[model samples]
Target: MSVQKPADPESEWLRQARAGDTSAFDQLVKPFRRRLHTHCYRMLGSPFDADDALQETLLAAWRGLGSFEARSSPGTWLTSIATRICLRMIAKRPRRLTSGDRAAPLRSTAELGEPVEGAVWLEPLPDGELADDDDPAAILLRRESIGLGFVAMLQQLPGLQRAVLLLREVLGYSAAETADMLGTSVASANSALQRSRQTMRARTDIGEKKPVDPQGLERLLQAFVAAWESRDIAAMVELLSDDVRFTMPPLPAWFDGRAFVGQFFAERVFQTPWRLEPLRGNGQPGFACYIRQAGDDRFRPGGVVLLSFAGGRISAIDSFIDPVVCRRFGMRDEIG
Candidate 1:
């Protein structure tokens, strides 16, 4: 079929887009962009990878417009294209393994490893990107879907199996549709889905965190920010659960238990006077942490700290040491 397949009821913009109209192409893809990006993020477990995959998918869709058969809906078609792009990306890159489980005890920050060079760790998505709409209440995605805990669990599955589980389970696609997207038979898709579900069940805690009060969220965030900036290890320790997890990506150490973590912070973290800028990430409260040394004129970007909450307590803190993640939070390089 030519680009001029006008009767293709799927995308009015598709017909114009096929006829070399750039605006029509923009119209055709804008509706799917955010969702497509999220899909890629789910499959790949990194926002940067998702951005690259989405761009590649759109480029592929643009070039392949002449082959657009309107048998499937536009969203499905875009999803099919995007999923394949992520699959290819996954094939080419090394998946960032979570080292928290295998990590040596984090006795001190002196032992923290250098950034593993490339994307060698699971990264987070800004919760702001979860929904296309500005009003968060209107968004339909579950907290579990975008949570770092869940995304890290997703990283353990094989790429296609991950795609199958995401498509069939999370995205609400039928087995047949998921199979089509994966270029596999329905039986294979269902088998993969079963295996993925079993693996996830065995490896990860699948319970979703219950919703918290917005005012409570903000209050806790403000308190945590104050506590952090004050460099009061005691105050910061009070905000954490007894079993809270502290993980810094690209560094192979994770500390568990409030007393150990509290002691670690008191001895290591509080040594540097910090300036924290509050932010949001992975649908949770986050901070852009800056450190001021004795002679430092301004506080420089040290890391991005992401906090996950459960039952009115901070349950987890993922501090990304990678500078790219810091930039993704859209903060200035230094705080004066």
Candidate 2:
């Protein structure tokens, strides 16, 4: 009897890729890219950083493919590599506050138009990125996790804690699985998960979970744009909830409630002639604010503002004035 050898799984494709078959490698990697990016984003909290880490992870996976035994699925292997890369990056970076950490406290509707400053701005994830068909629950979980508050809370944890919490809670990895990914004891992983949960619970009002109505949100946002463009202070004030919160980050100050917002806008923001160019942002309503140069009516890009709505009213307004942030949001120096 002759003994026949079994064909190697992935051997054909591997050979093709090794021979510079770009298409084959792309085919193998295409499906995982978005999910990998989402994972990296959760770990890093910065889309830019996630892109960088993803590049590194893919390159590492490609280079190390020879040793990738089929013991684990390709997705699992990629996730493990990406997780390690993010962990290393996080360890090197200085700790900063998450967007939620700096979220302005809720205020009454009368404070709606305040010109508050000095909070680190939190940008929203693109709607397309958040709307996943494969896993609805996971998508919602991811959205909530990426909220300014959640990101801020994440920043409070140590690098490893952040990774563990993201893996266990956000990604739904079990304790043993996370232990394997992070190369820690299961007990250590569990401990990190517990600590992360406790910190998040302590910092945020977890019980205040409110559902966002997308259509209603859009209506409120459209009204805001119309009012602001028309400089209708009354209209703008009318759209704000009684306890709307206004904060702009990288500055420490924030204004709570509508009266301060009204005072700030009436006294300062509306004092200047400005134009707003509408833009979609953070899966919600947004605008590019432009200031009309003195003696001229033409509006030059001033900054970007992204609105967050809660309970049918604008609750949080994130203003990004940094030139770098403007570039990231795909805004030009001038919008005509």
Candidate 3:
């Protein structure tokens, strides 16, 4: 007796979704959602922007479902839609900025300029929002790509170059596949990939340091947190690498070098009492800082600080002081 072939669930879902079934569309796109969201995050470098782009991608997918030929997997088609949406969005807005991109390092923190108005800063990705892959290796790769440094490196590229790099390198699409996704020739896609690779190499030193040691990192974070809570500038400075950088987004002022960063903490940051709650995002350790204002007994939300490591020492401290940033990380309103 001949055995019956197993039915393809994706094909079934696609059929239902095309016939105006919103629930079926959700089910059809559910498996590809997280990765596509990450792709948007990587493309746009802002969670808010990614959220907007993903919504548009799904809506477009639902509206245009009938036009989707079965030439590629459903996930690939979804990604194509998302990519085109991001390209249009990129064209409409100014590129997102990190503190490093705005101005040179300031020697003194006495005059930190006000938050630049109407500029979209690069936001951190909470670990919970990342891929829920079962494979350890896949998880690691995702972590590496979604790290702030990698995303910042991507921002250095032109929109087309960035899309080509992400599709070809991160998503593991072939050159021809990337070309199809971006509506370009295979030759142009390959050229953009080459140029993006070269630009990434020259722009950042993300992988130059030795891998961070987890045990060592744990000890370092504990010590730093304790020092921060106690307002011990010296203790905190001891944990920093000599060339450590301190960047507070929204405020263009950034400090570089251990001595300068330590001075800024002593002169400015430690003036107010702070309570830190540990958190992790973008595959790095961070804190949600609550500041106690003068005459206020309760500590209120201050900012979120994310750290980067090099040679097992703290290399960069990014303190996102925007209210939107604090809200994104689920910062509480007040705590005593």
Question: Which candidate tops TM-score?
Answer: 3
- Overall lDDT per candidate, in order of appearance: 0.81, 0.69, 0.89
Q: Which has the higher lDDT value, candidate number 1 or candidate number 3?
A: 3
Q: Compared with the true structure, what per-residue lDDT tens digits does model 1 show for residues 76-100?
A: 9999999998888889998766656
| Residue-level lDDT tens digits of model 2 in 1-336 | 999886554556656666677777777777788788877776776666778999999999888877777576677788889999998988887555433354554333334344433222334444445435557776566657766556656767788899998888877788888898889999999998888888887884421267557676667777887887778889988887776655554444456677766655666677777777677544345787887766865677667786766666777666766555566667666654
Candidate 2 lDDT trough over 10 residues, lowest sum: 112-121
Error of 1 at 252 (Å): 2.7
Which 10-residue span in candidate 3 carries the lowest summed lDDT?
A: 203-212
The lowest-lDDT stretch of 10 consecutive residues in candidate 1 is 134-143
Task: Output the lDDT of residue 302, model 1.
Answer: 81
TM-score for predicted model 3 compared with the true structure: 0.96
Top candidate (lDDT): 3
lDDT of 3 at 90: 88
Ranking by TM-score: 3, 1, 2
Cα error of candidate 1 at position 227, Å: 1.5
What value of lDDT does candidate 1 attain over all alpha carbons?
0.81
